[model samples]
Target chain A: MPHATRIAFVGTPNCGKTTIFNTLTGLRQKVGNFPGVTVAPAVGRVTGTNTEAIDLPGIYSFAPKSPDEQLTVGVLSGMEQTIPRPDGIAFIIDGTNIEKGLFLFSYFAELGLPSIVVVTMIDEIKACGSTLDDIELEHILGVPVIPVVGNKGSGIEDVRLKLTDIKEFAVPNKLAEPEADIPARYTSVRNIAANVVASPVRDRRTEFLDKIFLHPIAGPTVFLAVMALFFQSIFTWATPLMDGIDSMFSLAQDGINTVVPDGIARSFLAKGIVAGVGSVLVFLPQILILNVFIVILEDCGYLARAAFLVDRAMGLFGLQGRSFIPLLGSFACAIPGIMSARIIPSEKDRMITMLIAPLMTCSARLPVYALLISAFIAPIYIGGFFSLQAMVLAGLYIAATLVGLLIALLLKKTMFRGAQTPFLIEFPPYRKPSLKNIAVSAWGRSREFLINAGTIILTLSVILWVLAEFPRANIPAEMQPLQAAQTQLEYSFAGRIGHTLQPAFAPIGFDWKMTVGVIGSFAAREVFVAVMGQLYAADVSENDVTLREALGANISLASALAVLAFYVFALQCISTIAVLRRETNSWKWPAFAFVYTFVLAYSASFAAYHITLFLGG
Target chain B: MNINELAVGKNALIERYRSNTVFSERLMELGLTPGTRITLVRRAPFSGPIEIAYGHLRLALRPAEGDGIYILPV
Candidate 1:
């Protein structure tokens, strides 16, 4: 068998390192159009070839200040046991910023490995009225210099063919020790850069956009406008798709009812299996829609500017600018939000961001809030433009965001009090986002959500179905169908448990039925609405009737508000807990998050119920 | 004067950092060493991070770190 060769692509952030790696290996590593997209190394083999490529996270130098940087350092230094040292290194250099790239490569030279320099974004350099002589650069750096426009796939064949005989490439001469001082090495890098690069001009396009996007007052206004559009698109665009999925599920349920006998087996098949699958599939549209916007914004480099605008506000919450992206993403779903927190360099800041993410009131909690608000709050028009009910909904969103920030502040003060990590970010020049890359990234994120969270939601649905189905009670033959369902659930395990636990939640104005819904929602936040619909025999599907009216006739305004308050703060989604466990590599932090949020939810609900009662609710 | 005091769009030569911390080391590693020509591009609103250019690289530095790097007007 021919020996397989592994090559590592390394470079500073925003240097198009991942782009070249993706081109060579044919693997789309999460849209390498922006910094922090490739926070972890992605390994893939060259299609139909024996060569493999490893795309490491971008780093400025061998000195590691962040976890991702440490991973790159560990792998390159042969200290990481899992990732074997590569046979060769592809030192990716940015054509526009060769000086900075060479400064890092000076450190790479000390590794003494067979190396090749692949210069990316050559077109960007030319467009900026600069010229780079790759032949001259090769002569000065003493390695093969291949200039490639990565996004256009030009010069990639040269890279692939070069990798076949990479072992024969001559190692660049080492000019300094591994621990050499930076300023001295940079002097040598400056001399080398002076030879190959001519008439370097600042990127005029980026500078022009920055004037408006980064203007003190205009910058924040543009950001807020963008955010409003982003969030509005999620609900406006996703509603039709969500409604389609809802009807499809209802049709399947009707099919089951007509085909199967009216008995326990039919109930299990229809309510347990079909409903479980439907619940999982219903969330796909919202997830896909949310990811589409995130991918575009990140690719265009606007997200970095948004972070810059919000850095001061985030500082008051003890988080740096990097934490804002993850938190903004949390409003869609905490799973993606938690995963995006990988971009944060500091471990403490990352953890704090992840811990408070659930409090942002993810889309999963939207149904619960909607059901409660529609039931209790009257849709009275205020000022002829705003509806009181809609205002209440907006108030809930604002409250959740404020509470999330406060929690971050509290965690910083008590648990993570220490010297602050430095906040340094590079401003990559804006480029038109690639449609294909954006599509692939959004699809990848949606697929990940389906696979990781889908199984847990499916399993929990079946478990809750069982808890509501067993220990069926005998109803009088003349009793109505709704009465029979109520009787069966009241006698079932979930019902009995709810009745037993009612006294504990009584202070928060929860009755036994609401208690059951709360317990069921621990599986997934939207399950509360489903459980309530089933218990009342009221259809909660799109354009369906009676659920809202039934709930309104039964519960008071105080209890409804208390329930809404509880949903705002509770960390009830098991998928989020599972993601937290995976991200932190331990159960301790997830357990802490769950316990503290639960305590906070209970206290907040108690306060809301009594305060409303005292106000003559 | 330090970087925080440098006017936007003005040029200067960087001097030694006031403190020998990791933050300063990282800035120097990014080629912000003494004797390098630097330009204060802009500062974020609310006295947030400041953007500076040296050679071909543009970096955003928090005020806390930017305050430590002294510069000589040129």
Candidate 2:
């Protein structure tokens, strides 16, 4: 009958706050937006205890620059009516950087919340010949100061036990006020650090690494090379897994056909549900692979350096260096990327980043790109190291980035123009990435993709099947079976809609079938392939020979390129629009995003079709 | 002298902040108040933000904002 005891985890960025939260909560964390805002605050219950921990966004001070920071302050001060006041505070601080940590600690202490300090990165501190005396810190701060290695899970149990007794901890009534004369605040922080930390050595390892990683020229080159390898692996490594999934689904379809009679139910089970969902599900392997890489890069502390390296280039487009992390994250999927935009300190910058994030070639686009490129571009070695197909794949990615940058520039100059805030980012110390964290992250993201498959994609696939299958046209007396099927599709609902829209798409070389594919993909971009497969009566498996041959025989290279160009610009995914609406907290931005992208897709595809035709393709 | 004019590896004492805004207030909250000693850690290439370090904190400030922070050589 008692309300859950709420514990808040607060810290500056890169202080291993989330790592500790994950260690304590394990799989119990629930991600949801704070009341009335799209910034997600993860709340999780401490294992085997009645305490719930709210993981607040990382911030430097109570002064908020963005909606995310404002939410944190709002929740802490009980200003937001929706979030309850916390019963206790579990303040996380980096052990190696005690002064900054102490400053934040002092600031939060002023709120007079019963709090405990968990000094993380104890291993890194020990490696640097520094020692933190938690007992001495406890005496000075009048709260428990527990030294912990968050990533390794060392000393986590102690922190958990301390949380159980947090209600009994005395709240500091006269702690140092951070807003007092700034020098006095610094002096107080220094006095506390001196009392608890002993014989600290400068972190030379970080310096040496930064010298190479932050070097202007070398940094960008290494970044480019890493990206090159990243895209290459997405293509090469995912093929076998994708093919395996394709065969498994096809075999399932075969099993269904033999067991069930040839009826509408059988058709729905095999073609509508199996093939349609399977088509989208096959991209799961590539999405997982990309997420794993991103998680590792983020966990290892390289992503911040990457942001630092590219700040200037991004600055030219009026984007902060902080925008780099979210935009790069969009390459895997825009949902997480848009969620990560909370880290950007400026509101306008975060909005601009989210608007352009979908322009980054997401993994969903990879399936469509690969399909088009393999069907059109020959597999000849371009320069011994690269295949022509690989070049086109890379080119699609580059084109997406260029288009995103240009649009960001235009938005900044017009709709979102304001004073650009200076960039201020913390470069966290490099440490070995925890495999457990990476595994949890990858699994979490993969599960999200599968859930999307089961819900929205499933519903849309069934509807598409009905639209393509029902109201069969009577075969003409002299027509062959193939022509009869085509006629039936032309008369169906989806087919009718496609036919009505075909004239508009005709200049871009799309037939009614391609138009239907485009219409079906409004559910998600990957559905285009499944819809096309159904239209052609070919097995909707990856690399289906019948589908490829049929498509290649009927479609010109110019039309194939037009389709590729269309997807690169089109905001076709309904889920993306939903998230955009939710994140922006209004339909205005999402509507703008959808309309502009649709216009861009149509005009670009039209131009691409004509240009390629003119070039003799 | 302004923060942007400080050479890399040079240390300075923060004197006063020129711009009065929410962002400048945030910079002060991050311990960039007057009399704090700060060093020019590095300048990002292509006239990008300048990295400044003060008492275990490193922050990047664009030239425009950095120009608003007046400092005296330490």
Candidate 3:
């Protein structure tokens, strides 16, 4: 029996660290938080080899700074509570940035760990008209430096072969302690450049893109245009796709109703099975579509550029450029978005950002938006090139941005009075995104949402289906067909609970049946669809209620808008709140987020409803 | 003297930050030594955090925290 030699992988951001990790470990990877910390750790065992690899968060130095950097420090220091430190450390460095990579090399040597230096980006360096002298770097750093491109699996076998046999390495430590005047470290690198490296011959296309992308006004304009395109695509381009999905679900539900017995079982199939779960499943297309952009934007260097472009606006509202990373997170759900506010150095800025994050209108709200767009704002040509639905979506997204920040800024000036955090954004050199990597990330995130949606939505949908199903003791004649197939749920406690809570929602323009769906949606926003589906999926007669009809017949335009508002502004996402709990180490943050978001959702819906009603005249 | 009064190129050690108490302690823990040397890098583009190159590190301290450090121009 042989023990797997575990190697810790480390590197700085955008230096192709993950590329090396993937090359070494392949798909034998799992990512999760280090114990007591929310930062994700990637651990993988090299396939077909007796080696395990742990991918640490990228860091510029070993010293602790921000939470991200601190996380890197913890893992390297073995201070992470959950997992034991790796047996060996693999320091991944970028080949082209040999000069910048050296600092980390010296830093890791101080940890006195048996280590291997995995130099990445060799192809990039080759394209840049330079090559690495692995021997020279080894001589300088007193460590075995394996100069290999981690992306193409080039020189990867050499790394694995070297790691197999552990040899004691000790060179008179060339590492220096933090000096008082390290300015010469910067100067010497410049001198080394003039003598050793040739004139630049690498492609300059990345710089060409960065020019407009990093421009003050121009960069933000490009970012806004990209966002506008994303919204328009989701709203209009997705319409046909969504209709296709809806029709499929409808047909599936119709088939189920016909085959099933005409009793309680059919009611459960209709209300619990179809109406509750199907409604949530219908929005998967829009959610999946939105995820495509998220994965690509993350892979492209554009997201960072987008962060840089919005840094000024963020700073004005007391947020750092880093806040943009998490606020953009609202496209998923705001709880985690708000929870991500922990990265902000200033609590005032963090709190302010947390308060506003839910306003971003996550994809969960898209179903309601799509429903509203179809019913009310359906297509009108805009500039002969755009659909009115597209325009409305663009407007909704823009409003989320503008109105959210306005309220954030206003709150800062009043209740959360505090100055903004200073911006210290790291602008990594942009590169064309990798396709396989982007696909992997999209698969990962969509899978995450699906897993969450599957379990929570399914349970709540079934629960709501039961509640809407009934009491045979006082069964009404019109609902007689619903009884023979009726299970204990028709007489269950949940049904009574829904009826009990029905009156409170009456003023807000929701029927008791809809109120039951709302109770079930508490676990997740998307569950509202499933809960609604499950409630209605039972209407399976020849004139059986359709999911769409179930929704449309039960809900008015104003109520529909109200549901959209509830999702748009409500801070009901459980995963997000869970993340927030971890980030702030306080219930206060999630509580504040929940309360404020609901206040915003409720008030906004109330206002939208009355205005909508007045216009019906 | 307070950091805000220090001239450019002056060195100051951060005593403690004040704006966000949570962040102030956090910064101190990140090696913002009370007697360490800190040189001003540059103020933010808009009136934001005052950037300081503190002891082999560059950090942007909000104005309130920027006021906590004490020093004299080098």
Candidate 4:
């Protein structure tokens, strides 16, 4: 491979910048935001014989105030002080909003950075009765205008071609800007567009949709409708796909069992690798689906609208107007939730957001909650639609959000010891969401998550299998498979470790098994179910070995209730811990989150279990 | 007061911001600059968020944020 030319991808939020990046780089990427920023940076190599592509933060302009956007300007000018600079910038302009998108391009030109323009959503432009003259644009900008229909990948190969043939160059065709006042820049850019372009007044559909969707009373109802649809999509809609994945892994485990020897090797093969990892992998479908919708909302520019629409109400919670995006992301996983906080801008506000974000009840907690509730209190009728057990799961999730926000409110009043930050939000122009863009982005993120799980989750599971699987001398051969495994687990390092501190959990009515599951969950909340699945059955996906049968056979309803309470209140995903460490640059929040969540989980579960039993009696 | 008491969607602009807050960048990113226009969209149940349109963008801004904007009618 020849020396990789420095290339950077830059644009505004939801501009399909990352999508374009992924279309270029696929899985060769790393994610980090600007230093001390939570808005994530997706750095990837568009590896080829000679070309390497770098995707930077999506910024609206070179005069960036947000730290997230600051990297955009810094990186393009070869002044990304913390990181390497780029040789060329591929400026992605939303096709329908060329005039507005040009604002940033104009900024890059003023800085004399060589840039190539890639027009995203060209299809949207045509549908809207507009056209971009790439030749004229190229002439005006003096850079090769690569007219890419980013959503269709109609000209992606061409974009790729130009990237590979990049050269060290300078821009001599940039427009000069006088003074540094930001308002002047907007005025000037608006003036520049007036001379060269004429599109019809506003699109009538926007006003039509806005009438009902943004209506006074009807507007909020519409918002609720849309959000409910989003939630249902996360839970019910993703189920079948998740089940399909679950089945494949189950079949694989069965296949392994058929050929493998039946002792330590069989147990480890069926239990540790398949069942353990399989349980975690089932959730990937939901993660991917969530990303699909998220990417669409972001690209179509409705996400900002939703943020603006709700900012007035969420602001009372001391969150920024755009907090909805990050908060919604939390429902999928807290890593993105914390990462999205980069948009908050203010140090105080951003920190508060990161602190409370983990409390949002990520989807990873759903399986554990479902497992416990189904085995314990699934009544004959649920909330009249969902199963009664499912309602409880939903209730627990909602309750966590309220209680967490309540705690944040209390903390902001005292511990934070800072004044309330003023907040504002922008609502960018409406545009058709690019399907190719959204698909590429979703696939990219899902790929990253699966990779993280493959390496981190696998290593931890192997190490955990060791902890649960040694000291053969301690167990008698005649015991049942589970009993034998339990004996070994009890004698193993993991079990001894659980036994050493058994007194602490005893108050919450936790058995050594529950203690072990909770400890294992430190790596991920979903791992709790996997641990329980392994502890209770020979393999997790064995049809007869449902979560119900496992917990039901050994533990009483009340103990099951305790476990439910434990998962509900405990913030136990290690990815969240890792992200918090990186975001806060400390061990403080994760440590605090673990300690307090354990405390809350224990107290809540203990209270729930005993109280339920007492009431029934 | 109803929106008529204020101008047609014009941002009230900041008078005095509460100190040590980092929300300025967030507001700026959202296109909530002073002298900007804000068109009220909708409100959810239980006194939830109010959706609004600003600078060709749309979202729900909390009432507290509106109050913080400290708008004086144009």
Question: Per-residue CA lDDT of candidate 2, range A128-221, in tens?
Answer: 8878888878888888778998778989998888877666556653447546655577678878788877857767887788788778778778
Q: Which digits, one per residue and each the tens of the lDDT, describe model 4 over residues A574-607?
A: 7788888987789987788778777877789889
In model 2, the clashing pairs are none
Indicate whether candidate 2 or candidate 4 has the larger lDDT.
Answer: 2
TM-score of 2: 0.94
* Residue A374 lDDT in candidate 1: 67
List, residue by residue over A1-617, the lDDT tens digit for candidate 3: 87777777887666777767766665567775566776766778776667777777677665555576677788778887776777777788766565455555556666788877778777776786766666666665667777776545679888877766556333324455545123334343434433433444534665567557655567667887898777766666766877787788678767876899767797677666665556666777776677778767866667766665566567566566777877887776575466556566566777677777777878876765665555555467968887877777666777777878887878788877854555544334455566555555555556666777677777777766555555444555666554532434345565567678977766666666566666665677677666555544444333555556556665687777666656666766777788777766789877987887777777877777777788891
Number of clashes found in candidate 1: 0
**Ten-residue segment with the worst summed lDDT in candidate 1 chain A?**
A30-39
TM-score of each: 0.88, 0.94, 0.81, 0.86
TM-score: model 4 vs. ground truth = 0.86
lDDT of 4 by residue, B1-74 (tens): 33323443444433333332334434543344555556655554455555565544555544555554544443
Report fnat, model 2: 0.55
Tens-digit lDDT track of model 1 for A325-396: 899888878987987787787889999999999888687776787678768988788797566766776788
Candidate 4 residue spans exceeding 4 A from truth: A26-40, A45-49, A123-134, A155-157, A167-172, A178-180, A377-384, A417-419, A429-432, A474-486, A538-544, B1-74
| TM-score of B-chain for each predicted structure, in order | 0.95, 0.95, 0.68, 0.61
**For model 3 chain A, the run of ten residues with the poorest summed lDDT:** A180-189
| DockQ class, candidate 3 | incorrect
> Regarding TM-score, does 1 or 2 come out ahead?
2
Ranking by lDDT: 2, 1, 4, 3
* Interface RMSD of every predicted model, in angstroms: 1.3, 1.9, 7.9, 4.6
**True-structure lDDT of candidate 2:** 0.82
